[model samples]
Target: MIRTGNEYREGLKDGREIWMDGEKVTDVTTHPAFKPIVDVRARMYDMQHDPAYKERMTYRDNNKTNPVLYKLPHEQKDWADKLEAVDAVMNDIGGVVTRVGDETIGEMWSLCDGRDVLASIDDRFSDNIDRHIQAVTDNDIFHVSANTDPKGDRSLSPRDRDPDMMVHVTRETDAGIVIRGAKFETAAAYADQAFLKPTVGAWADEELSDYAVGCIVKMGAPGVKHICRSGFAGKSRAADYPLSNKFDEVEALVVFDDVLIPWEDVFFYRHTKAAQYVRSSLHRYSAFPYVLRLLYVADMMIGTALWNARQTGLDKLQAVREKIADLVCYREGINAHLTASIAAAQRSPGGLLMPHQSMLYAGRVFAVSQLQNMMHIARELCGGQICITPNADSFEADGSGEWLNKFYSLNQRWQADDRRKLLAFARDLLNSDYAGHRLTFVQFAQAPHFSHLAAVYQSFDFEGPLDFVRKSAGLSDQVKG
Candidate 1:
């Protein structure tokens, strides 16, 4: 059941309680600051109904009557096709869908349902899995995952920190529960309905059960407030920074003031151990694809960096070519690793999980190692041009127009104004608040951080290689014989 982009936009009009700049956001769908983002999300929703995209964006379910398209890799080629379909849609534009809504949250939910984290709750989560999956697919929502707790102080546990710093269940009832506290660095708070999770890292003990509460609530629900970071809220003109204008990935802090969540929407309650289960689902299913997305991003950066170099006549220079090659190496390394992750994937009895340790480790290892390389390439290729380029407004101005043109033009292939625009865009990509988002993806894309990488690498059966080495060394019979 795919919704049209118009339907998707109209759907956001539902009044949700949201706050920015200490004021209420009365209408997210139509608000100047939020409208374009809603439109972008709507475009994602509309993809399913598009004749060209329908087959790829949606798939037939096991019931074979309904269709599903999600991030979970399938053993069958068609299922694999489904993964590619979803990736192709989101990965373009670097997966920076302005506001994180269904696409992002649904992927995490898919992870949870696929891994049986939510299913373990008396099959309650499993029952709604299909329905929830359908709802998100139809809507094409972007999910903003909020997993990090405001630790208050680095030394304290969540309980030791200001309890208000951690999102927790302050009250519970038969109907549901009320959660109080804040989730920081939420990438798409205004766009998503109901925050998902076990609320960061909670233990299994009864004392921590309140923190285990997890459920979905419509955005702008009674007591929820969204506080945006300082920046231009509305769309800026092309004369403004290209990255800032066309594709701002909005990140905000959210406050939940005793927000009520219904029981049906709740996946975990008063079971602290369930938090790990829920997280296991999210990190594996949703987060892994994000790495794949970042790899695509690296590819984009490489191309842009190379083009900027060539535009500057640095393409013929050996030093510049070395930088380009370095970026390509990182790009290819990540792509190859993700390809392996997909190819080696399997569906466990628990659900679809990408536990190919070798692949996961390789993905993470290459992710952080290559990020600096890409950033450096951008720095070397563009140098001062990115920072010093005149804004689009300057070029449009009559007073300095001629001088700007004479100073900024590249070869005759492109005009001076166009070259300046590209430089501004490249600058934003290389350095901006939103650019920090890329680093965030690499740093925290996996929960438990490097531990997950180490676990995957450690769990790999290296014995296969050890045996081969023994055979090559002609010592195979020493132990077996």
Candidate 2:
């Protein structure tokens, strides 16, 4: 069931409407803004077929081999296997790229856990959930998520304002339902499909609402328009901004102009309870991979700072070593949460093993909330040269090249070209425009700061603290009731 690199590329030529930088992109696989990221995704597929990586990236089920990333988790070992697969891919690609596939598939698993709640509304909806989960594994599909809607005028209700502000079921047909609205999706332009759902709102009190609907959306279907943001690739030489050139995952505002959702694809409709269930439990499994990406990011920061210190002989100072230790603490703090969550994993309502909810959510908050300060520390260690240093061309020019060589060359071990290359890399990672965008992505991509705190608030076991204080202070027994 594993697909090859070319097969994955050929699937994107299905006449999907995509626009970027005031012009239409004819082919996403070849477009300058999207081609580098597309190739990174394609290389992941190709790795599954390579002899050296085949055993690590895929698993055998019966007689057929399937991607380990897409396999449904049943035991603790299954999660360990998935973590290993992600490590192999990130190391091979040389950079981190979320929303490729593994990070979004767990959104479906979250739906599977709520089948009983969905069945109470309609049994057919529960059946639909089971079928879609299998389809992704069988077809080797690339799936993404659609949750944030463009809600206009917070003071006015969706019905009072523009009803099209949120995705809603406009009308029901014998074959399916028609939907109208827009959603902000990260990788919808090149993804095969998206699990479209309602955004966060006051849906718990409502019994029935058009905005409370969830279903599967085909990316290439009619009436779906992908209006993408300007990309960072091809705007500058790759020698200066390597991460932006290869790892920019373009976000898009997808306009669903009365798109059709067939009956088989509909998981829930016109039900507020289902919507609330999905909103609360959306990242049950997905947050693991989302937070895991920050671990690699921390490593990048630590590596950049340490290499710069070694180049300038600043590592010999005690104060410099303390700063490096601070960076190490941030990195290990994230590592501790992830490892403990797996060690104390829990079983889901659907009989699947999930990372311990409180530990995972706490890890997400720690990793995302402190990213800015961590980047600042690394930037300080790298020095001001990262921002003022000349590009590669300046170092190769005739007149300026001689002066640049004399100033940049630190020692025989640290030559001019190597110093320039390191500075360029540190610039892109910590000081470039792309760096700011990445910081924002880590903060708000999963949700905002308040939402991360909310997850921790809801998942933590408050009763443990309450009981300890009550016993220590010798409070009344009636408080227990």
Q: Of the candidates shown, which would achieve the greatest TM-score relative to the real structure?
A: 2
Give the TM-score of each candidate. Answer: 0.85, 0.98
Q: Write the per-residue lDDT of candidate 2 for residues 238-318, one digit (tens) a residue.
A: 899999999999999999999999989999989999999998898899999999999999999999999999999999899
Number of clashes in every candidate structure? 14, 0
Model 1 Cα RMSD, 1 decimal: 3.9
lDDT of 2 at 448: 91
After superposition, the stretches of candidate 2 with alpha carbons farther than 4 Å from their true spots are none
Q: Please list the C-alpha lDDT of all candidates, in the order they appear.
A: 0.62, 0.92
**Residue 85 lDDT in model 1?**
64
In angstroms, how far off is 71's CA in candidate 1?
6.9
Give candidate 1 regions above 4 Å deviation: 60-68, 71-73, 76-79, 86-131, 134-144, 185-188, 199-208, 231-236, 351-357, 445-459, 462-481
